[model samples]
Target: MYKSQRELKKDAVRAFLKDCKEGRFDGAYVFSGEEDYLKEHYFGLFKKYFLGPGDDQFALTVFDDMSFVLEDFLDELDNVSFAMSNRILLLKDVDTRKLKGEPRKQLLDALAAVPQGTAVVFYYDSAYLAGDDAARRARQSEITALGKSARLLEFSRQDARELVGWIRRHFEAEGKRIDDQTANYLILVTDADMVALNNEIEKLALYVEGPDVSREDIDEVASRSTGVNIFEITDCILSRNYDRTLRLLTACRLNREEPTVILYHIGVMFSELLYVALAAARGITSVDTVAADFGVKANRKFILRRYFNAVSTLNVDFLKQCIGLISEADRNLKKSRLNKWTELEMLIARMISAQIRK
Candidate 1:
């Protein structure tokens, strides 16, 4: 049967939960994904089923695959649990993609013969995986081999709709409410990292006495991630808010953000703005249509209005010049001996000056 990727993920989670409920802990399991929240949640659930209080040190064994020897891990698996029916072996940050030759064969053999009375979990945070195609193929092969004797699961990022629902439920659990619009706005102003989102939600719940969470509440309480800060900085540049732009640039420096990174983001923002502006000039004014054209997310579609307004004040030639300036700054930051902060400051000053002169 050919199931869609979404369907496969859903089935994997469902099967894992069923096994946990039935107390049918497998001999070996593999968790490979980018979503840390679900990964940690399932890890806790497995622990609850396999161990009791104070049993971790006795019955649980943890190893970092990078440093731990394969023979040592296999030896531990062969050993019996201390004062428990089963031992839990957790292998963290195991990127099978990097395994080769002897180590790879040893790991495959161990997976084939995971010792009795041992619950082994091979966990990897996909976020840390290398972006190269070779690494990706290696990971896929590893997952396939492990799947022969282990329950393989993957946790992917949720879409905007699911995120909004999660936010609403979380707020409700804390005796508060957040409307859909406000929830989407929250996502727009933050990274899609669930751990950070959960922390922000909890902070908002504690800070706001009212039942409803507003955009104002988010702005005041939620810590802006670097991505969010870059977006704000770009917004400031587009609006020609000189003081605000400089303030944000200072904030970036204070936080020790690299000048190259800031310049890269600014270039991206300007490029995207140019695309939206060009589309609008061609009479595509609908936000949904324009966003779809640019492959922008629903939550971020709100930025189109700002982009449109900013683009109205500037021409295509000037936007291209701004992009060129950012590129030049990036090169100077990397190749030249100039101070990073000074180069970034000059870039921003020139960008603002260009906007004014236009």
Candidate 2:
């Protein structure tokens, strides 16, 4: 059956798991995507499946394609497995866009003629194909040719619901419980990177020493990702919570977040708020429309609603003034000799004071 790229991506994990269960070993495979955790996890599974309980050093071959010679890779693939029925060859960081002319043709030809007992896997850690359109097209053509004789799997970011389920299972495996609300809170406070989330979960499980992990536990222990802290600062500003705003800003600085980065995020939040405010004035209250107009993801609709409500009482002139203040602070951070911290603190103070006066 023919499937679109989107469909293939959507079912990539499920298909791989099916192949794993059925013991289907294709001669060649391609693993590319943004989700490093999933890619690495599946790679481990493949290793176990192919190598079994034997010493992997004899059966497994890994190469960093950046420095790897194509001829050497082909030589290794042609060699029979010493300790297993099949040899597993892993090529990491295979940036196809960089491969051109004779080397490219030789690699593609070698992939097409992979030995019967050899399983070759190309792993790309990047989220997207790099280079100009021509280079990208050439890489896509190579991938398409490989797809005819292999499995091309792409791992994308999991949405909120998928993340929630993953969090639940992670806690359950440790004989601990995390309620949905608490799980959602954890997701909000952290960047939705599974690797980071897993680390936090491990830390929380070890610290709680209880059957249930609570929201308070997460608040006390989980490191707030930079993006989350930035959002919190903006939320505080929108709600007119000056004390909380300052505390969040302090937390950001303590975490070693750069002053300019903080200012940049503040600027973005105000700009978004200004757009929402203008949209509301035109009587556009539909979440879908607002999301489409402002590029907000579905999972973040609730946060957008908060922004919409907060901005309802704010006028355009005030929003403009806030943006102006942020811009000035940004320039000062880059050009002025003043202490960056002091300049940032003054910027936040001025924004808060302006909001209070409004």
Candidate 3:
């Protein structure tokens, strides 16, 4: 089977940790990627392994925010500190590739000749090396150059399997239990980032009355992403709960979610629901079979099930009308200066009305 980038990175991170635990040290390392939480996490472990307890200022040097000087870095690297046996120099947000000609050569040469018991870490914080197309190409070029001299590790978001396991463990640590399915559902509704998920897990642990976490508990307590809010709004519409639907739409506005973004999700929801409706008509009702037909990821099969729950109440004709309404709203949102919430409210009314007439 083909492995994903995230899976490769996850395996690399595991190997890196194992090496650290076994006292294996690299001369210089580059930490780069979108997973800020894990990057910061492993950096803590890096310090723990390299500097140990009660780290001294003399043992560690941090150069950040354009404060790095080549001479100063070389001096620090060669200082041979008596305060500690393992010394580390951290270069945060420093683009070493900017050093041209001799300076760049010297930097590489310094890395090559890094003294025993000393280590250097070049950390590219999230989004630091990314922007436009040119910037991204430049970042890649820099990473390629640096990779030749340092151990390069990219930290990105974990796959759904890892995230699901993490959620289950967090609940377990809180003296509560959550099954794989419910934990995965939490990930679906909430932000998948570790920081946000951690906070949500804490909230759920404290708010739940029983030992086992349920989907109901998650729906009641977990923070909803814009996607989740729109899902709820669609569900309410299917149930003919107009008041609750309008309330959720207003809540989306209050949360500062853009109407265009909200409309885009609404369109997607209808499209998926239409697919479910068609599948039901064909007597293909299994969530897995429908999800596979639609190319939905394994982690998101719950979404298909949700749509299936509401599909029995609707038919293809009404779903097609809803999509047409969304397209019209999209045009209005682009062409006019109408009160955005008013436009969405009107769109909701029309969609609900379409269901009523159907």
Candidate 4:
């Protein structure tokens, strides 16, 4: 139900803080996601917003195991907030498969009877919901029953374009500037993780002069010569020049990098490109819409604006082949028997290079 990551985090925090500030936060939450820092950041946000950055504090109980009984949750829920403040029962994901008939039924029944003046929040992996029939069913049931009383906040991952802008925002805040190539290079290296990318950019910027960051500056100032190498490989692939691709591949291997990581990055890039190319061939005018259709939710708007020209180059067939090659390479790259570098090299040369339009 939630569209973007920012919206989910902001809206959820705001609502919880409002309730906590009003002495109303109660019941349980299923907080989920693979991003450990963000998860912990949210916990801090809950503390700050509810605890008022001052004298009052929220009481929180955490349950992290599948064997946790239904009464464990209710017992905490029944407890009043310490001195007129909010209380949070944080339920980490439970193993639904492990639950037998009565336990499963009891869990569902417990969900149905969460106390009034209490809110139940679920933080979970975005992918986890697909297999979770009970969670999906519970949410659907809530929409019909709880009205505004229940809230579902979703945190989504950033698409490419927004991720780029996020990189730019970091540089801007640090009183630094970088060209498109440098910025994209940095993002590619960090795998679009804003926090890591920003930190790396700051380190790079610190090595340079005031307010002007560039590719040359990055090359000169980088201490380890390891950042954004993935972007360099991507640049070669996008240029559609086999020599460049080969050259970059050699450079990466010479640097003592993990061969599988290279293969994985290439696989991701080509897959994203294929998404655009196929969508364009199908008459989707905007990457934003296409991203939604394909569930490629990262940096979509930024990707459309910046990379549309490149994406529009490939025909649907090209995208299909490219995706197939990437898939095969992905499976092969991790194999114990194959030389990862060689397999990746063949994929780039045979599959990706063959798909080059110009």
Candidate 5:
């Protein structure tokens, strides 16, 4: 079996946790990746290790991209804590690559010059990393310089199996138990964001009367994400349930989802369906292979079943037609003055009509 990105990061996370437990000190560290929950969880561990049963509130200083001052940050690094613990400086979501010219050089040099007794952490939120192409390129370019002076660690999202296991463990800790199918259902409805998942888990644990959790309970209590709603919308279209499709789309609008955003996800769903159809025609039936080839996140491979099933009934030509309709709607959204919801409903109507004519 091929090693996944999460599997590759496991050793690093283990080592880091061990170092924190053992009080191993590094001058500077960089935390960046898609898994925000791990970053925060491990940071809590590190804080406990460093602070240790004392009121050492002054030992740690935090700064964000907007609030960071190079001189002030350097000053904090230079100062040793009187409380006998190492001083720690945290820089949150500050990508040094965007600094430009001399400021960028100064920041890199400062990272290298971090005193032995002080530790600096640069945390990159997934939101920042998920930015436009230009920002991503800058992030890539900064890694070389950042790597020279700091230990770089990435906390990637877990695979589906791992996440399901994690969900079970969380419920077990809360004195409740959830089966795999219900766990997966929760994942489907809530999307894969761990912080959000944690919140929902707490809600379910409190809301459930018995020890066991059910899918019906999840349907009753857990909040649905727009991504899941998009999936449902696609499923409705595929099933030729025009009324439910329009109702769901209207619900999305009421929830304040933009037409462009909804249209974008619809376009992506159709595109992926087209890719799966092409792969099927080429005699590739392995879900794992197709998902890996399509660059689907490991945690989201469970979604491949829906895509494959949808593609089984959909010809490439129809999928292409759906994509074309999406493109035209996108153009209309940009230039035409038709009510946004009406354009979207018309798009759905046309997609369903195409399927009927088939």
Candidate 6:
């Protein structure tokens, strides 16, 4: 596990420079991250650093599917110029957010048994790659283990604050600045989609010649974005502030977000708290004990700790009732008897009242 975006960027730069300097057949490189620029940046390197003028590098290709086989790319790589020592093959979107299936497997195999004198890169949106599916999780570990020879660059997903910081860095990188008001506006508009936010910043920087970009600039240039923050929903429930709760709810419906998405978010969080509640009821005495016994996701521990504090005074009977609420909500969402959003709203409201963790 490579964990930092900067680390990945540095490794990529180092790999490209090394390939150019040593003339070694660097078999393959894996750029895994949520940042889209990694794709354009490295692919540009393949063009500028390696492919000289008048070089028709048929050996270069971009693959969105991870299942892309090394054999399938052999035709392109086989025609490699005797003059140029290595070829560039890009297997993009390997984790299958943009593409999937046989191509993903093929790409993995290419990384496993990469041909000499060729530079291949297998890319994935690491945010999606680390999602909770067991099989997907195993596939990532398998690929990392098998591609022992390939240099690995892993890009971790940016959270809300980090994404905003990235936006600030982008402006600074271009020798421009965003005004405080404009910065907040951009953050609000992009809603922490780093890729989209970066794109907007580029356009705004180009449109305005001054060092400072104003809030008005963001309104005029940045794309309208949606989707309630996962934290907002959780925080609202924890605080039990009616207006804030309804505000998030209204944001959800106003954005035309799918009820299933909201349910997925809230349900997952509640399911976690339910586990905490259940653990405490089971005579589990401490946070460390609950964490070690259940073996939950790392981030979930904070949420678990909150649950314990909230429901400390509640007895086992109330905890059982809360567990039943989550199950009922899940069942209702799965069925068609009532509107999904309404059912979720009601479930959340009820849970707040239940004082599972007041």
Winner by TM-score: 5
lDDT of 2 at 159: 58
Over 4 Å off, model 3: 1-4, 56-58, 66-75, 80-83, 95-103, 127-141, 230-246, 256-358
* lDDT tens per residue, model 2, 1-358: 9984546787877878778777877788988766788888988888887667777787878888567877788778777533347788887766555668888788778877777778889887744455556866776676666666578887766656788999999999988999988888888777677888999999998999879999999989998888788888887776778789888878887888888778876887788788788888899877658867887654555456667778767898889999999988888888999999889888878988898988
User: Model 2's lDDT to the true fold?
Assistant: 0.79
Lowest summed lDDT over 10 consecutive residues: which window, candidate 4? 142-151
Q: Provide the overall lDDT of each model, using Cα atoms, as 2-decimal numbers.
A: 0.79, 0.79, 0.83, 0.60, 0.83, 0.63
Q: What are the runs in model 2 whose C-alpha is more than 4 Å off?
A: 1-8, 80-84, 126-150, 240-247, 259-302, 305-309, 314-358
Candidate 3 C-alpha lDDT tens digits along 294-322: 86555456677778878787889999999
Estimate the TM-score for candidate 1: 0.79
Cα deviation of 145, candidate 3, in Å: 4.5
Model 6 lDDT tens row, 290-358: 766676533244446657876565555654565687678878888858878788788778877876454
For model 1 the local lDDT of residue 273 reads 88
Clash number for every model? 0, 0, 0, 15, 0, 11
Backbone clash tally (model 4): 15
Once model 2 is optimally superposed onto the true structure by TM-score, how far is the C-alpha of residue 91 displaced, in angstroms? 2.1
Candidate 5 regions exceeding 4 Å error are 1-6, 81-83, 140-145
TM-score of each: 0.79, 0.77, 0.69, 0.64, 0.92, 0.62
Off by over 4 Å in 1: 1-7, 23-26, 50-54, 80-84, 130-151, 271-322, 353-358
Rank order (by TM-score, best first): 5, 1, 2, 3, 4, 6
